[model samples]
Target: MAKIENGRKSVDTRSIRTISSSHIDDESSLGSDSEINGFTSDRQTDKYGFIGGAQQYSEESAQDVPTEVLRQREVKWLDMLSHWDKWMVKRHNKVRLRCQKGIPPALRGRAWLYLSGGKVKREQNQGKFQELDSQAGDPKWLDVIEKDLHRQFPFHEMFVSRGGHGQQDLFRVLKAYTLYRPEEGYCQAQAPIAAVLLMHMPAEDAFWGLVQICEKYLPGYYSPGLEAIQLDGEILFALLRRVSPIAYRHLEKHKIDPILYMTEWFMCAFSRTLPWASVLRVWDMFLCDGVKIIFRVGLVLLKSMLGTREKLKACQGLYETMELLRAIDARYMQEGFLVREILELPVTAREVEREHHSQVKRWKKIRGELNFKSPPRMHGARFIMLAEPPRRQDLQQNPTIVVEASQPTPQLKKSKEEKSKKKKSVKKKQPIEEIPNPYPLLSDPPPPPKEPPAPPPVSSEMPQIPQQTLIDSPQQEHPPPTDLSLAKESPLQQSTQSLSSTEQDTYL
Candidate 1:
């Protein structure tokens, strides 16, 4: 065995050395020479088709645990995996408790597949990833994804070098997704998420897990529009008022907006914000639970960051407040205490759902009232129009437009040259199929911008803030991203045409 740098060490490369005269007997404990040499890599994987990374077992953190204890935990988890369905059905609470405690590293890959319904999704969508992988992705998104690949966990062992296995797998998974779901295209946030998944499982499995995340756990989240994020930002604001008034008031007073901090937390699932260990623990629970874990984790971060009125009052501006939140001490987010606090939070999933619906309705009404010349933009997704969730049959039949940006008002006065160019372009127009207007509200153009309303009064005593009046300006209503959202498509649904901002300090 030899020592490695950065507190990471390597396993003994000489473990596989053998002699020709060596003989095996029934009395011997070793099953075979290959088994003694760790099953020659092939059999190293368990029954679940997951090849446990050798690096995971040699980490300094693993060294801290007693060997016997680690082995026993792995054995227990292996037994659970053996009877996964029975255990889940008969002891759902126990399963959740185990997940909250954290899945054993040896078993995390298979456990994630099972917990996120990745296994089932993979089975149902057999060969979908391969098919998607074969196709070239939308070049517009491929360039963006390529730039972000090296940026995602650059220091981690898997992604440390350029064109490494981790980066390659991440590229394949993200590229496959862009082809699979042309509507959503590529979002920068999806890079870190896919990178994390690749560390736990193969690229194919990672792709399915990402899909489950997009469709099941957090619908409308990663798409160009980021509609879910905008709605959820309001939900967070409303929830914050109830959970920690002092913190909320401090933010309002300082003009610190939810979009400033919440986008990274929601988009990356806190992968970049929290320490690696804490991020893994959050992922363990997040896969088991759903997006609510994100909300719970976010509340804990806020409380820890601004736990006291004094701390909240001490903050002076958006930059200072965002920095305070981003630099939360790692000790505060330790899995043990953070999970317990999250469990004790006053908010519930049901409450979150209620708030989401209320906020959405409020957003629709605001759009109708303001009729702003420009539609609201959050991340990539545009606020084209509001519509009820279409029925499943309708979605399958019509492939409804889930997101679309309102066309900017055309310039009325054009130069003679521009007119001539427009006429020539019309003459060469290709036959583009027009998608029928999906919603009545979007059919009519917005009215002229109305007079801006008076700013809402801020009060800790008030539980529900008027959604439209929460921010001083529409720009504040949807905070700008540190990175630009993908802007290659005209509108995104199941499939559609292509159609073509932000200030940020301390975005993770």
Candidate 2:
């Protein structure tokens, strides 16, 4: 056992250096001798390859969800991705429900790409990331980002080695963003966000994913003064009043500011606060549902920790409350329970918006005017609107099929000139059937279906149109196709077929 010196256990510097040197890979890019000292020991890691602290994954958590169930969810998610636009336009509620259930881990990266609109952004801004990456970023932001590199997920194997590929990729992504949005420069909060994105995607893909998070999902969040976070902090406090009056009173009585505790939680999206599995689960919902999910999660944590008098009794003073919020109970942090609590919380987007308006009014009253000019915060995945799929007309036009009437009887026939005149006259008299447009302009509601004109009184004198033509016409309603072969194929096969060629190219 190591000896205790003064009130702390003393670590042997020589032994640590020897162990670290022995474990160091020759290929590792760690340059400085001091940096090499920061490497972690080859301690056993959890299933997710995270070292030390409480293990987020265990045999029990794994058994909590069965393999077959996970398989079913993955299949459902693939089908959803195949029809992403349709789901976003018409069935967003179903999408939200599936997200709440927990996205399949294997497909989380792709789902995040889709939900956050990162894939669309990447496609739209092709070569933009590479352009930013090629330039040397501003030295100020680069220096700060470099220092914070290893601080992100240091316990995880991917970032364990100093100057390793993970840190290198993290550097590229964050530096690229500083170049991409020079005004915002860089925020420490963004480092962890980019790090999390890089874990699941390529550097370019992660950059765009970070872009969506910074610009669309949580706008103004990482700006220099963090004004948006402050606004959200007030919004969270206002919301807490409704969510848990007891918790609200406790915080108010102790003069505990929401920003003090929530800045890290909201800024990092709880990556540091929660267990690894729980973090992924929260992210899955956050991307789909947007910042409201984050608000609800914060409310849940506050209520769970301090809602009751008995719970608050121990948290009597400011330090106690802050400590409790900082080091949340393990039981309260469980993935399943936390998710349930979040879902059960009654906070809504409208309430948050209303509270935001109120807070802005109060801020103006107190401080006269706002200082920063931040863009409006988007509530959720409104980016779907910008990336909507093209209409049927925008794609290849349907080939026009001409249907010929049966040949007229010889007696009915006339001279060649007369026959042509009669044919022209007959065509002018016939009513043209209107095909209803399936893809209607989003701004306007689809016109009600028109009833098929009563079949012209069938007469021996009239040429008969083929019944098959009417049955197969675009106007006719047909049940959606169900392919037995597609059903027999595995989820992976279905996903490949469902994704368009272009989508498959950029999905990674």
lDDT of every predicted structure (CA atoms): 0.63, 0.73
| Stretches of model 2 off by over 4 angstroms after superposition | 1-42, 52-63, 382-508
Best-fitting candidate, measured by lDDT? 2
lDDT of 2 by residue, 1-508 (tens): 5444323332322221133543445534544222343434544567665655434543233325689999999999888877777787788899899998888878888889878877777776779988988897788887788778767876676775555667778888998989888889899999999988887878998998998899877888888778789989999998899889999999999899888999999999998888777888899889987898899888889999999999988978999999999888877877888888999888877888888889889989987677765766666664444445434332221234878889977666767668899899998876454332332223444345655444444456444433432322223244322333323444453334334323423532
* Worst lDDT 10-window in candidate 1: 378-387
TM-score to native of every candidate shown: 0.60, 0.69
Q: State how far residue 57 of model 2 sits from its true place (Å).
A: 7.3
**lDDT measured at residue 98 in model 1 versus the true structure, 0 to 100:** 76
Clashes of 2: 0
Residue 113 alpha-carbon offset, candidate 1, angstroms: 0.8
- Predicted candidate 1 versus true structure: per-residue lDDT over 89-148, tens digit per residue: 577667777777777787787778767766666766668888898887787887787778
